[model samples]
Target: MYRREYKVSISNYPYCNKKVDVKKLEEELEQDSNEQKEAVVYIHIPFCAEICDFCIYCHEQVVNNDKIEKYTNALIREIQEYSRKSYVRSLSIKAIYFGGGTPSMLSVNQFDRILSVCKECLNLVSDVEISVEVNVLNATEKKIEQFKYSRVKRISVGIQTFSEKTRETLGLPLKQKDLLNFINMMGQYEFPVMAIDVMYGEPCQEKEEIIQDIEIASDLNISHISLYQLCVIRGTKLFSRMQQFDWVQPDESMLYAMFNVADDTLQKLGFYNTVIPEYSKYGKESVFWKDNFNPQLDRLSFGASAYGYLNGRTYQNVCNVDTYINYLQKFKVPLDSISEKVTVLQKLERDIILQSRTQVIDTKYLEDEYNELYEQMYKETLQEIIDQQLAYREKNLIKFTKPGMYMQEDIAVKFMKSILEGKSRLYKKMVIGNQKI
Candidate 1:
């Protein structure tokens, strides 16, 4: 099985014609002295009982209880150190997402302690959405109860596929029975939101298997469904075994077919809001999907390998757990990488990209705000995409046609290329210095 990779050219597109003065924009934003913005915090708990072959997140396989304890303590120390330096004042936490390597692997008591620390460090809203990512292997009735008590209103469970063969290939823990039981338990708790993460295009997955997984998820009445396409990230076990496993990813035609099937099925079942490439649901109440396109809400991240966007800059913590812990021990911020401060123009572009992912972008507003960029880079490409039925354009809004949503990343790159090629003066050393974990 061979997977075909598609390349989209940005040079010839109508939207790729613009030149942006990156340096000028950056200086203007800095001179304005804008107040810092409130942000959502993402805490990455990178410990798992077993390493899934397809997982690329920074996580270590926990060998014993001692390692878990140490990791929890390190996380607390890191949080305290960051709070003191950042002086988290009245800035309310919009969302606190505990992601990666199975945060549910921590004991109930450990989770409580961590949540307690978070509350003390930041100003939290009454309806602040707190989410934890859990693997089915670690998710249990007891764990769900603990999460609810901890004020965690949302749960995202990893149930990549219902097929046993695919599970083996992905090296995921939990049997079909275990997964079903977990879903039933979650229903009992009726957590405000219950999301399941499923993967398509795995080595052992077929079109029919994908359909079956969606049907099962819908039957369970989960609040949201994140249907991800499998990608073999560099350095992952799956990437190494790609050849041996005869893994086959869907071709363009097959991918298009898969998307249609999912879109139709999920929508018919009332999961109409397409949150991202891999996510959709039936409601407006979810924090995960709420105001995702808003430019005002900044994203804050913690733990190894997590990234945060705050004020006008983006920062990433050290990716190595040991190094991150060591820095915390010395009472230092453990950030290892940072991107150039985000400019107002860049933020506008980000807002456009995020909105475009939902298959709807207000072209008029974008054109009015980024008139120069529209003339330079997006005009031809936008028309071309619309002509191809990949996107639909009205007076001021250009939205992805169903097919365009699957290739949103490619579209983004095309837009970014125009900026990258024309703006040599925009490039600068990152404020946090370049460090790879």
Candidate 2:
């Protein structure tokens, strides 16, 4: 078994202090003959009436109409600017996601205008999977109707928990009844697919509470669920309250219990394939699963503090509204950071990590496509994973046994240890700490 130790401080280097000139990056990517054309667009609408204490997303409290108008205009300008440079009008966009603060908070007119601008700029493919992330409180009949009229096919609603006590602790504004009513209305309309976002491991959450949340979701016949463990991101109200809370963040044992409960419960409810470590559903995993290769798909992000994956690289937009608006006003791309240009090695590692999390990795696929790289790492570290019983080779596939899945993060860290050390040999050795995945 893999040894469990105190969390090591894995340096977030390579990703730190990196910014890309959006125009330059796009040009470079466009010139790459090997670049794939399939694209996904993400629009960030960062206006929220109230910021959740646990939320670390780049968002602002918008209490005034003027600020909303200004933000919308800025978003439009950013879209227009990107369209001009990327020639997006001629490209087929496969998916468009409106996420953050509260995408549904926009007035119907504003939402329509934004969608219109996107259509004007990008050639949205017929049957493009359009999704909008909404806060339960902000969703209304008019908003849902407008979204349908705009051709939005998916709605990802944030309903972290159904327990009133947990909801209060989470500072969620809506009640369980309101959230259920919203889900019921969506079901009545057959809103293509409704995905519920749930959270676990909250400060005072009990096992029963989480199970109740799952039961409620399954009863509603929600098409998909994105279950996430509560994380203490650095600058959030929840982070500040972490100390005073009597509840303990689930330890490795507790996490295993939580994961098993959810997995078993969801499977019994006929939600089969685990899409991501935290996502699952009954039918074909959502549009996000297309192409099968996790990292190959493109993601375009909009809004304050939104991150997009495109052309084999990741870029994040400015997190502050004023900064975003200011940059757009100056006819510049509103970007804050461009994470490191992902190398082939990094891509392979990502695939390994993602596959390993599911308790399976296609060893033949790795051997066939990445023989040389796979051999090098297999010799160096893969043996250890096998020895620890975290992974085992089964014919052409390397699968993480049941016990292995619970400790997948630790295995990934072991792989990362070598890579990170090689990349920054002179830097101080930082260990991965007790942070939850």
Candidate 3:
């Protein structure tokens, strides 16, 4: 909040050094701890027909039919294993998201088989938000029809940018004209939500390109838009080719301008920012995006490179397809890592961070619930941010200005660090206990 060099570190998931205790996870689920939450599922289909330069998410290109069949079988078996756990039986599934390299690439029969297992195993609640990610190339009418038959609530298509040059630069194989036609065709259907992804801050894209992307999406009558900024992550193909292309990353000022344009233009067009990147016409309830954005909701993930959150812990499956299949077939949970228990302070910070990403944080609840800690945060963290013109309080709600949204992560981190350093009265009272004061 003070714009110091200090960083705020909140534990979304804690790291444990010991070997993963698969049996321990099962035991906790079977015992039915008081903290058990209604869970959501994130199934990762890590196969793409081709890889994009900017994509750093764990994935592989479609290689063979046997591998796909093997992966699908393993994924089902993994879900069944969770079904056998006691806590899972008691919990009602809020949503199930099929995300990945290309979930829609699976055959219709494969979709039926996997969904049938979900019907048999999980307590899928009525009106569940069943969403699937589909690449435009693979978003066939047959597949869309299959999604409809399966009662999928939303379809996510990532159209990073409409610029043919940019798309080609990103390694997209489809022609720009064909891509537009495909999206239009999908929108004509009666799906509950047809969300499209528009990206900004790419290597050579200007602000006008971003505006055009938004304009095109709006024209298509797309129900939702996920506006994202391009990032050059380490270990990605983009990172490796940064020098070859002489990719000039946009400075903070340029990036902020792009964000403001998108935010203003989209809002005027009747789409509000539901989360950091997602803008929706029907508000927050339109899709299950909230479950992933809100820290309070527990998400259980499956398949290669999938991450899951339960109780106060987070875990991920193995990244390799072969390894994931082997682990599941051998009757072992394909857990690559499991986090340690999250702390109270970390939880508090996460709640504020996630909530404030889209809307203001209502301090009244924090004041009544956390009491002294809330007071301390107000004085040492929140007040300072207000003074810096980063955020403002409207009665009980503290909201970030447009400029502040760009630095949301950094600001959240600063506040958390202040709390950790005992700047709060609550911290001093509970931790130090009048040792010297």
lDDT per residue, candidate 2, 317-390, as tens digits? 77789988888888878877665566767666766765664567777777787789888865457778788777
lDDT of 3 by residue, 1-437 (tens): 22222112222433332365645666677775555467678889988877888886778888677788899999999999988877778767888889888897788988788888988999888878898999987778989888888888888898888888877666667787887898878766778788888887777778888788888888877778887777676677877777777877676678778888988888888888776667898643444676676676777788997877776666767889999999989988888767555566656665776676665777887777778876765446777777878889999888888766656655655544423454665553332221111
List the global CA lDDT of all models.
Answer: 0.68, 0.69, 0.74
Ranking by lDDT: 3, 2, 1
Between the candidate structures 1 and 3, which one is better when assessed by lDDT? 3
Model 2 stretches with alpha carbons more than 4 Å out: 1-23, 29-36, 86-91, 289-293, 354-360, 378-380, 402-409, 415-419, 422-437
Mind giving the per-residue lDDT tens digits that candidate 1 earns over 1-437? Answer: 11233222111111211133223322332343235556677788999878888876688998787877877888898777556533344356788889888899989988888889989987777788899998777766788899988878888888888888888878776788888887887888878878888777777567887778888998887868876777676678887787776776667677667767877777777776555544555443456444434556666567887765555555567788888877777876766655455555565566666666567777777678778876666678678768877788665678777777676655654454424444442241111012211
Highest TM-score scorer: 3
Cα deviation at 365, candidate 2, in Å, is 2.8
Off by over 4 Å in 3: 1-11, 14-23, 33-36, 283-285, 376-379, 415-437
lDDT of 1: 0.68
Candidate 2 vs candidate 3, TM-score winner: 3
Each prediction's total of clashing residue pairs, residues at least 3 apart in sequence or on different chains, is 17, 10, 1
